[model samples]
Target: MLDRIANIIVELKAVTKEAKSLARKEILYKDELKKIKLENVALRGQNATIIKERDQAIKERDQAFNNLPLKDNPDNRKVKELLFANKIVCQQRDQALQELSIKREELLKSLQEAKIAKKDRDISLSNLDEVISKLEAYQNICQEVKSKISQGKRVDADLLIEYAERLLFEEELGSTSERKLDYLENSYMFTDQASINRSLLDR
Candidate 1:
């Protein structure tokens, strides 16, 4: 009977110990729940203050905006006019730049054309000078030939050699004969010195 009582006492002690542990756990859980509730109340107060400040800031900014001038003010109209004038000036500047570019291109083209024309004129003048020199040499040779024959003088071999390549046109020597240059070169008056002497004496 004593053993049975002791077992019953032990079981009762275990039950009491478990109940105390559960009580301790319940007290800790209640404390944590109270702390969480306090933190939530603090957060709600902070949120309410932030909302009030935001509302006050918005109201002040709106009232300040209402005190400002409207768009129809004189100063605003002047700013608009200045902006329009600036736009017009920019357009005119662009147009002038475009015209300047076109004029520069035209000037360059004209310069190139004038340069080409000048070059052609220079070539033509050189050719005319060469032709004129040849014509003058030919005329001198014909006159020497005529003079030597009429005066009975021996025409030099050098003078005959020069006329080998020279011809007298009707426009140059006023001769109506249709004789070519080589035909005159083979004539008696323009041959060797012996032929020139005989031809001159015969004249």
Candidate 2:
């Protein structure tokens, strides 16, 4: 009867210990559940804030897209006007270039004409020089002939005839040629008019 009482006491202690352990586990489970619930509540609040921000961003993007001009809008007309103005400027530039080209051509033509006129003037000056030389040569011949006649020297008939012919044919003597011909016929030692005439005709 005493051993039975001891075993009963031991069994009571074991039951008490197990009950305390289960109570402690229950309290821990409740604390963990409370923390999870708090975390879930916080996550719900963060999700709501994220959704509100996403909706606001979408609204702003839509409003910005709506402000852009459509394909056939009046803003496109402004672009067309600008293009037309640019075309007009380009046309004016082309016209100015054409005028410049025409002016350049005119200047070149004027320059060529000036060159031609200068060349013609030079040729005329050269011809004038030749005429002056001929005049001087005729004057010298006349002086020589006059000197020979005044001094009563024997004039070379052949030389005088040749010089006269040269003045008449090979060169231009203007009025001097006529005077010298007359002087030779009247004052020279040609014995007769026929001899002087023959010498003149021989040329």
- Give the number of colliding residue pairs in candidate 1: 0
Q: Give Cα-based local distance difference scores for all models.
A: 0.53, 0.58
Query: Mind giving the per-residue lDDT tens digits that candidate 2 earns over 59-161?
Result: 5654654566785345666557655655665565556556555655655565566556556655655654554455455556667676776887556566565
TM-score of 1: 0.39
TM-score (all chains, Cα) for each model: 0.39, 0.45
Worst 10 residues of 2 by lDDT: 1-10
Top lDDT hit? 2
lDDT of 2 at 40: 54
lDDT of 1 by residue, 35-147 (tens): 65565556556655655665565556546555668864456655576557556655655565565556556555655665565566556555545455445455555565667
